[model samples]
Structures are given as structure tokens and as C-alpha cells.
Target: MLWGKNIYRLSCISSGMSLFSNLMYISFIYSISAKNSDSDAQGLVHPIRDPRLLSGVRPGITSSQGTSLQGSYYLRNSYLRHNLKENQTGVPLFLTISVTDTNSCSPIENALVELWGANNHGLYSGFSKSGSPSSDCSSWLRGAMETDSEGLAKFETLYPGQEENRSLHLYAIIRTDWYEHSKNQTVDSDSSHNAAAIVQIFFPDSLNHQVLNRTDYKITGRQFVKNKQDFIFSSGQGVLKAKAELPKSSICGGVQAHVQISVDAHASQNITVTESPYQCKTNCKAYQNTTEQTTTISATSKHKPHFIPLAVIFFASTYVFYG
Candidate 1:
């Protein structure tokens, strides 16, 4: 149902909470130094200023058929344990979301905070198929939960991997009481509810360095990319730095980091806009699924590819139903 300026086409595009005993969670990251390669950190992150500059991305790698940025398909607890074997390879990443009213600094209690990100190997769950209209959308890395009374929502998941030339990051949607439902909700021109905010939480390049090169992360023999090269940042404003704790095991130590997000408590409905990263170079490869054949697509080169600027797609389409 795409009716462009002169042509036509079609396209399309999570939550919960719990109260806290003031609970403190853990992110069991290993502090191993990465060996493959290096780059200077950008350390640049910006708030979503224009809502129509829409880009909902899952790397668009296997999705030449396109994907809905509004991936509210699964809303599980903080522990996103859908695939047991893949979950085992992941580290314990404790994600804490602290929600507050920007002007008041008061905690926004019971806010719905939904989060999703790529796994340690750079593939998202449920939608990794490379064929047209990808089926088998079961996954482990995407989930949603309600914030506790303290305005915090915590998740236990794996560290995300890198793709393209960008640094690793997580995507989230924060909603006030009226904006909680991502799948069926909409914001009006004269909004009566608070607008939703789509955000990306970037991990520090230093920590990303250590994590990406881990034996579990898979990609080897080459250098890892840093913040300086990520497409989302004009610089490195969104990189979250990591803090190390005492070692819990022989392989790695316990590490943690926390981030605070401000959601507008008032209204001005916003469509999640996106800024698609410049397309990457193509390299062909083949693989097999347990019961069938499948293809994995990538825009990467032998060496890490650099990002270029593309005219941002500022359209406002959630998702059109197929049937």
C-alpha cells in the first residue's frame, strides 16, 4: 500500500514492569582485552529530534524484502531464554532501565520499557532468514517488561555483537501509560498522550573491544570496529562505559553498567523514525539449517567496511498487514 509522490509500493514495521525491593542485578562481562584490531572512540550520541526521519533497523542484511521496525512480536520477561543452546553461549547481561520525567527528575513509575538487540554473533532472533518474507520469526534477544515502582526495568540477556562498521548497541521504546502498546498504538497529529521515544544504548568501544574478540563471539583473524566508525552517531554521544567488578569465575569477571532514560510524561504522539545506515559491501556465503537449507546475508567486506551517509527515510508507516 505504498502510494509515493508519483509511484506506489508497500512496507511495514514490546513491554512489562515489576516493582523493586530496590533490587540490584548483574552483568557478568569478562574483562579480557581484545586482540584483533583497533580504532579511536567517537563517543557521540544524539536524542531523536525529528520523529519522521524514521528508521527501524535490524541491519536490513537478510531483509532485502524489508522488516518492520516495530518488532513488538515477543514480550517476555527480563530473561529472554527462547533458544536454550544459543542462550548458553551468551553472557549474563543485566539491563536496567531507569525512567524519569525530564523536567521533574521524578521517577516515572510503571512505565513500559521494551528492549531488543543483536546477539553476540550479530544476528537477531526470529527474523534471520534470507528469503522473501522471512518466516520462522522465533527469537531470544527481543523482549519487554514493565518498570518497577522505582522506575527501573531489568533484563538478563547476552552481550550484543557487531555488524557493518558500527559499534554494538541496543534499541528501546519507552511509553507512558497511554503509549505502552507498540503493536496497535498510534499517535495523533493533536496527540492526547505522551509520545514514544525510540532509543539506542551504545556500549563503550573499550568494553565492546573486549567482548567482540571473545572466543564465544566467533569472528576472528581480523580487527574489531570502534565507536569512531558507527553510523548512528555524528560522534560518540551514546556510548555507555563499563565498570568491572570482582571476578566471579576463572574465565571472566562480573561487570556492570547502568543508564537513565527520560520519557516525556505528556502528549505529542511520535512515530518511530529511523536513519538507515549506508548499505554495506556484499560477500556471498552458504549455510544449512537443521531440517532445511538457508542463506545468511551480509554487507561486510574482508576488512571492516566504513559507513557512508544516505538520505534518511522520513516516512510514517507502522506495518501493513499481509492478508
Candidate 2:
């Protein structure tokens, strides 16, 4: 009975995990890059100082959602608990974005990136503290990638689901200066020149509906282009659009839901060399003194405003019954 109760509580705490978890893990990446002997080959990547400040309107095209529905996991309860290899879905979708110095037009090989989003069913894959049965809560859906001198970084996972109010999104947090040859480096003016973009990628409204059901996803906007859709994904026109639509495949060994879309980043942009090419790590003392420390505010506090008191009541109920 005690063991059963413990398991029940564990399940309750993490009924689902989402892309938001990736946002919190941004501070933990340590700087290290693979070494190469050639001087022409070896390059410097600057640490980003204030990532949020570099933002403008998100371009209509992006590298990354907000989501509603439950998805079908092919694995049964028996398979879910102990053995997890690849997700039963065939190959989870993979997307790569190359970080470049705007001036030098070179790869920002050491840029650190954190990414997260919902699964195809519109649920986030990893959201909380419970141990994942089919996989570790800290598994591969979200991860950190360092760019190569070629200025490229890649991630492999499934496409996200569309949720109400929130549009489809892929949230990413990037740290500059955490690259090869530049470990533990401070952000000098030479390295502090920040030029990075956090843009969203969107599917055509027709395709979005086709993936789920047309009746469910009605087109609300005025114009339709072969490529254009979401305002968040409007920039970097050449690199951001999907090359082709992907057909459905398996999630694991089991059959996966039909896949309606897939994309590859093929656009090339000019990168400029900077006085400094990388941003300093946020945890670094020099960086921290200059940067504002962050604190968590409840999402509802900004929205519903009265959510804190209701949350307290909910917590009290949990303490009385489950505690």
C-alpha cells in the first residue's frame, strides 16, 4: 500500500512535462568546445550579454509553441516504466540552426542553446519532477548544442501540437561565449557584440488543419502564401521556410500518427566578425553584476491576477489530503 501510494504521488506530480522545462535548464550549461589545431580553423565565439534585449519582432519564420490534446504513445504501461530507447515514433523530427556573427559572416561555433516545445498531441514532453517511465524526464526532447565553426547547431525531436490561445512555438534560450577555444572567457568589447535572433517557424494554416482535422483548425487570417503564415515567423525569409512536407512515420516500433509537416534550414546568411564574437556566460561574476537576476512570477498572476490565493487554497487541500 505504501509503495502504491508513493507511485501514485509520483505520477500525480508529473502527469505531463512540457517544453518550458528547457527554459529553466539554461543556466546549467558549462562551457567546453572540441579542440582543433589549425589557426584558420579555430575561431572565437562571444558570450551573449543580454539575450532578451537583442530581440525585435520575431520573424515570420523561426527555428521553434503553445498547446491542448493528449497524444497516443505507442508504448504500453509495461514498456513505459523500465525500457526506453527511441520514442516509438520513427525518428523524432530534427531541426538545425546555425548561429553566425553578423559582421564576420562566420559561425558562432560555441553558442549554447536550450530548446523546448509540446509533442504532436499538443502536450509538452517533459514538464516536472517525476521520473519519466519510458525515458528520463531529463532526456533528449530538449538539450544544449554548441555551434561548429561552420556556425551550425542541431536538435532532434518531434513537431509540437497546436493549443488554444497560444500559437505553435519553440522556445529557445541561448548563451554566448560558451564555445570551443573560449572556455571561461570574459566578454570583452571584442566578444560582447551581440547579434542573435529568436524567431518562430510556422506551418501553413491548411497544413496545420490537415495534420489534425480541417474542421478543428479553421484559417482565421486574410492572406495565404506558399510560405508565409504566422507573424512571429516573418523574418529570415529564405532560411526559415520548410523545404518539403514530411509524411507520417512510426514514433517507436509502434505506428505513429500521420506526420503532416517537416522542415530543414537551408538558407545562408552573411555573418560579420565583431570586436568580440561571444556573450559571457550569465553565471559568470562579471556578467552577473551587469545583468538583472531573474525571479519567477506565476503565469496566472499576470493573467487571472487572483490565481495566487486560489493556488494557496489548492495547496492547502493537497496538504490536508495527500500530505
Candidate 3:
């Protein structure tokens, strides 16, 4: 259910409203702004609720390194990065991308996008695993946005830090549609599910590179280049491209990188899927109609105000328990 050089951000929810089931209601939120030409959101599973499993293997890439990043100068974070627990409103570094369909290259407007990233300290906001308190907003670094006709999605946040040599990276999830030609095809097919791809955005000339020596890491910005020449973008080109432009300090305060993502037209608005439910399948490879039945009893000579009776019954039950 995954492939290619995509800024991947997948989430899988189970049935109902259980703690894990929240993913089911996520359908309304499946949209994203892609940075490359190949951004998409077509998964084999009709309702992909298990993100970790359906998200494919975490590519064989080295982790993020922080040495080269320490000595580097981040104008925006010059005063914001160190022990930021005291600060309330962190500078918002806007991360925006436009997503498109690969086959037709048209912008898939109104597509849902969700993103999650670490803070300047390489720690996720509002999480204990990244050294931030559970009540902190760091975990909230993740965000969601719908694409415009131009297939653009944007977010305002801060530059993530390089902690414990863990590389700074961003994860994204985009939702689109499948082309009719791809209907009935297996999820394993490369072109079968084309709406979504796992992509990695790296700091091309990051100061951390020099301080961390992450050149050996697989997911490092260095690995993004195939021949150590190209920006290491994946085959078929990405819909968006990102850059860091930290402005001058003083009247401008600290420097901040401007990440601009230009979407590719070829990869947008084309629904590519084999044997979709809307098409009415008879001999489709991936077909399943899950339904459940429940029975209910109604009171005869029904009275009005059902809530009053229910409240009385609840009060009686509570009284019995306490008495």
C-alpha cells in the first residue's frame, strides 16, 4: 500500500470509536499538499486503518545526524532554540506544498493533508518520548490541511532541532483518487494505488551536516541525491521542492528558512484505480463488502419524550446501586 520517494504521513484507524478506531473517522481528513510530481493518496485497502502496517517498511535509510547542525547558525532560533520551555509562542515556520496527480498532472483540489514533525530540539511537540512534557505542544507539530485547486497545502511551525544526533525530518499524508484504468488491480501493483507516497524532506546545506557527520545515514539529506549531485529526489520527479532561507537578523529578528513547494501539473486530479466500488465490480481482484446487522425492540403504544423515560430508568438504576 506504499511506494516511491514521497513525503509519507499515513494513519490507520480501526472500526468504531475505540482509542485506535479514531482512524475510521479520518476519511474526512485525507488531504495533503505534495512537494513533488508523484504525490498521491491511493491505497489498496478501501479503509486503510492501520497506518504502521499498511505504511510499508520504513525504507532502509540511516537515521538523522546532528553534529553538523550544532555549530550552524539559525537566525530565527538564535534565541528561540535553547531550553525553550520558558517561551510560549514559538516562531511559526510555514511548511506548504502543492499536491497533484501523476497521470494527468492536475491539481487535486480539496485534498486532505496531515503532517507531523519534531521541534528544534528534534523532539515531537506534546510528547514524553522526545523529552517534552506530555502537556507540551511539541507533539502538536503535526497538522492537517486541504489542497487548493493549485494543489497547495501549508503549515506555520518552527524549525525542528537535531537531538541525540537524531536527524530532523517531516512526515506527510495526502489523499487523492485512483484512475479508472487501475481498478481491480492488486495493491502490490506499482501503479495500482497512486494517490500517496512516502517522501523525506532534508536540509540540503544544514549546519548539522557538518556537526553530525550523518553523511553515512540512509535518510540523510546527502542520501537524497542519487549521485551526490541531484538533490536526491526520487524517480518521476516530486510535485514540490523545499528550501531553507533564514533571513537577516535585527529588524528581521532571527533567520528563518523559506520552504517553497512547487507542485507538478502532471500528477493531479486523475483517479486511477482498478475495480473501485463506485464502478460496480463483478470480477475485481480487490473487492469486499463488509456489512453488519443489529436488532432493536420498540415499546408498543409509544409515549412522547423518550429521554424522560430513559432518565428515570437511569435514576432508578443508580439508586439501586447506592442503596
Candidate 4:
């Protein structure tokens, strides 16, 4: 009986040592995973400041410089009157725009927010310019909405793909007093009443990389410009950049981007609108004419399993049994 008890004690000691070793290994893995998660969160929250700005490089585009010719194509007829979220391809982007008064720092209600961007293939909906190669007048990733009493406007669109000499961006024209305009009305310098700030909203480079690497955007090739290398992005001074985050409970596995645009409601910036020579006029058609539908995608939760505590409890119970 004494010999049998000695062998049992030895076996329990050996088992406890093995359990302790596994606990240490698990702890090390959890620590490393936590560190990596923290690093990723930091990157999402705080993007790197443009290096060109630090070098005293003047921006090619200034706030007072107004809108670019490329942005001028956002006319009343360019987009459909239906929901922009309908029949869209690529990863979904839940974009929210908050319009505020620069002078009062208060929300600007009833403001018209028009948003336009390229599709997954880096093609604009209505234009046939060098970079935007659509001739069918198909309106895919473009729409307009009015701000609510809280000065918020939301749109569901696809993540824009890259174009030549430009980083991924969304063109917006916010107007304080929007009136019934002709179908030929284009956002221009003379249309000051309908144009408050014609700004381009940008995304973080890290976020851009993750989205663009997906299957839908990957076929566009790798010959696109980075935010730092792009002249317009360098000149914008990061004020127009959007804050991107993962949705807390998104049925769609895409990103949520938000940007608060502060504009002088009373003042009108002179935005030049030049006609594109390559503009497509014939065979113009809307992408989808069916009834609007909202599609939701389920995302897998990233929460880690609570196994450590259970492991500790089991180890304690084992030790007590042996004691």
C-alpha cells in the first residue's frame, strides 16, 4: 500500500508540471495576441501624418482653391434619383457625413450632401475621362442626401477603387441652400449657392490596403498612387480624411467611415468646372432600375474565447485532488 501511494503521488506531480507548462505557453500566446491587437487599434485610430507636410511642402490644392475639374462632373443628371446603395458591387462602405458651420461650430441642418466616387474597377459612373472610363452614363457609386436636424447624412456605397495619379477618394459637394436646378446644372464656381465646400474625403492607407486587397478590388492591378505621393491628398492637409472603423454589429463585413466637414455656410468658394472632352454622351443608362434592396453580410466575431480562467480552475481542482 505504501509503494502504491508513492507511485500515485509521483504521477500527480508530473501531471501538475505538464499543466503548469501549458499554462505558461498559453499566457505567452495571449500576451502576443493582445499586443498585436493593440497595435492594430492604434493604427486605425491615429494615421500617420503626411511626410510632405512636415517637409514644408505647400499643397497643390488649398481650401480657397475650390474644386478641381475632375470633381466638376457631379452634375444633377450624372446620378440616379434612386438610392445609391442599390445594386452596388464590391465591399460595402457605410459612410456618414456630418455637416457643421465653421463659424459657429454647430450642426447645419437641411444641407445637401452629394457624394460621388469610382467603382471597383476605378471607373466613374457618368464620365469617360482618361481615368474614368465609363461611356454608358451608368450611375453606380453616386448619390445625394439632405442632412437631418442633427446635421447628419448617411450613404451606403462600395469602397472606391484606385485611379491613375490619384489615391482612393470620394468627392463631395455640400450646399447650404439647395434649390430646384436644371438637369444640366453642374457643380461649378458660379453655382456658389449650391456649393459650400467641394472637398475630397480620403481613407487611411492601412485601411485602404486591407479593403483594396480583397478579391473585388485586387483585379485593378497595383499601379495606383499612395496618399502621400498623391498631390491632392498632400495638399488637403488631412483635414478631409475620414475616420474608419470596423462596425460593431454589421451584417455586412465592410468598413464604417465618418467625416465631419466644417464649412463657412455664408461664404461661397470659387470652384472651377470644366467640361471633359472625353465625356460619354451616347448610350447612357442607369446601372440598376429594379426596386432598391439592402443586403447585409454577417461578420465573424473576433472575440477571444475565455479559456484561460477555465484552465486555471481545472488546474486548481487537480492540485486539490492530489493533495
After superposition, the stretches of candidate 3 with alpha carbons farther than 4 Å from their true spots are 1-91, 129-138, 177-195, 206-241, 250-323
Compute the lDDT of residue 273 as modeled in candidate 3.
19
Give a tens-digit lDDT track for model 4, residues 194-269: 3556778899888777777767786544665678887878876423889999767642487888999987755543
lDDT for model 4, please.
Answer: 0.60
> Could you tell me how far off, in angstroms, the CA of residue 287 lies in candidate 1 after the best superposition?
26
User: Each prediction's Cα lDDT score?
Assistant: 0.43, 0.35, 0.35, 0.60
**What lDDT tens digits, residue by residue, belong to model 3 across residues 75-173?**
100111112223323334556666665556666565545455555444444342322112322224544555666667766655444434334445443
How big is the positional error of residue 43 in model 2, measured in Å on the Cα after superposition?
24
In terms of TM-score, the best-performing candidate is 4
Query: lDDT per residue, candidate 1, 293-320, as tens digits?
Result: 1112121232123322121111111112
Residue 9 lDDT in model 3? 22
Task: Please give me the total number of clashing residue pairs in predicted model 4.
Answer: 1
> Of the candidates numbered 1 and 2, which has the greater lDDT value?
1
TM-score of candidate 3 on Cα atoms, chains taken together: 0.37
Candidate 2 structure quality by residue, lDDT tens digits, 120-182: 544443332233332223232434555556555665655545543444545443335322223
TM-score, every prediction: 0.51, 0.36, 0.37, 0.58
By the TM-score metric, which is better: model 2 or model 3?
3
